[model samples]
Target: MSESFTINRKEQLLEVAARLFKQRGYAATSMRDLAAELGIEAASLYHHIKSKEEILETICFELASKFSNAIAEVNDIYFNAEEKLRMAIKSHVQIITENTNQSAVFLQEWRNLSEPKLNAFMKLRDAYENGIRVILKDGMNEDVFADVDEKFASLTILSTVNWINEWYNPNGKMNAEEIAQKLCDFILGGLRKKLVTDINYKP
Candidate 1:
């Protein structure tokens, strides 16, 4: 077979693996199950990938890398904390919408990875969260955001957006960017500092 065909087949294998891993959980999915889904011999899968764990590692790391790079790109610009957070959310939404199945696997099946990869993946996950925390801290320092705990706020933001994979509809009333902007509006509403002279003042 041609090199392009080989690449395409391999991508197809990953896609099928992602679907099975998402539906059945990584540990419950076997090479035979994936091969059956693809209507290929179980042994033929070895030609494309090494093992089920390798497939899990591939899916998890690929999405993690995308997230890390998205954060890096957002930070590279001159935007303030709020703008950076908005950009980050939009980027995440776009990534999820583009790869919903893979995103599901990445989010839920990541823990199935083995030791060394697990530690490495956890480090990357922490680094990505820390990037968000840095933005939150910048906002707090600049008086753009409240003095809430950065970890709590970051987790809140990530959890809020990560749920989009469950009900995201491209043909719905809103696109990914619009959905992301609405989420930003909602999140920033809570994150923004409150003024003492604001409405319903106790004084």
Candidate 2:
């Protein structure tokens, strides 16, 4: 196969593995099953990679990196906390929607990692989560996020956003961009309504 075709095949493998892992969990997804899904012999699958863990790592690591990059990009923007939060929500959701497979693995299989690798991935994952929490805290400090409990609010937001991979079908009613915008509206609206009002005008 041509180089492009080879790359495509490998990507196909990753995508399949992501779904299988999501549905069956990592340990249950045998190498033989993966090979059969890809229309190749079990041994032939080795030609492309080392082992099943390699595929899991590839999927999870790329997603961890993607999440980190998205948060960093949002943080670098010259905007206020509200704008940053909006952008963070939009960017994070968009990345997951675009890379649903990797997103699934990242959300579901991180716990299954072994040894030093699990610790490393969890560090990156914590940074990503904390990046969002920082945005929320900044919003709270600026009085843009109202009187909400920061930790609870942050986890609620992240959990809701993270689980989008479970029920969200891009082929469903709304397009990815539309789904993201709707989520932004729902989250921001609630936050906005809870904003602390001051007596700038006596009404």
Candidate 3:
């Protein structure tokens, strides 16, 4: 096979594998099952992929990188805490929606990863969560956000965005941008809510 065809075939295999990984837990999926889904013999599938775990590693780490880079990009910009948070959320939802299968696998299957890889994946996840928490901290410092529990807020936001994989449909009426905006608005509304005293004050 030509180099280009080989690459495309491998990518197609990964895509199919991601779908299966998302549908069935990684532990329940097998190379034979992946081959059957792709309408290829087990041997042919092996030629394209080394192992099922290898496919899971690729999908999980690729998405971990996307999420890391997305928030990192938002942090590099000059926006205020609120805008920075908004942009970060938008970037996140875009990654999730654009690669729903891979995102689902990434969200749900990382625990199936072995050894040092799982360690590495957890570190990446912590860094990404910290990146978001810093924005929340900055907002509190700037008085743009209420003083909430930083870890609580961070986990809540992460849980909310991550749950999109369970219910989000690209063909659903709401597009990625719409979903991102709504999420941002909802999150920011909570973060930026005023105290009753502040609301009652006539300054």
Q: How do all models score by TM-score? A: 0.88, 0.87, 0.89
* Prediction 3 global C-alpha lDDT: 0.88
Q: Tens digit of lDDT per residue, candidate 2, span 1-203?
A: 54453557778888888988988889888988888998898898888788778888888899889889988998997368878887888888898889887788899887788868888998998788789888888887887777787778888888878888889887889877787788876787644554345422124
Model 2 off-target regions past 4 Å?
Answer: 1-8, 191-203
lDDT of 2: 0.82
How do the residues 1-203 of candidate 1 rate in per-residue lDDT, one tens digit apiece?
Answer: 64453558889999999988878888898889999999998999999998778999999999999999999999998478778888989999999988888999888888888899999999998999999999999988887788999999899999999999878865788788788888987887655777876432446
- Give the runs in model 1 whose Cα sits over 4 Å from its true position: 1-7, 190-203
* Alpha carbon lDDT at 12, candidate 3: 88
Write one digit per residue (lDDT tens) for candidate 3, span 76-178.
9846998898889899999999999999888888999999899999999999999999999998988888889999999999998888889998889999999
> Worst 10-residue stretch by lDDT in candidate 1?
194-203
TM-score quality measure for candidate 1: 0.88
Instruction: Superpose all Cα atoms of candidate 3 onto the true structure and report the RMSD in Å to 1 decimal.
Output: 3.5
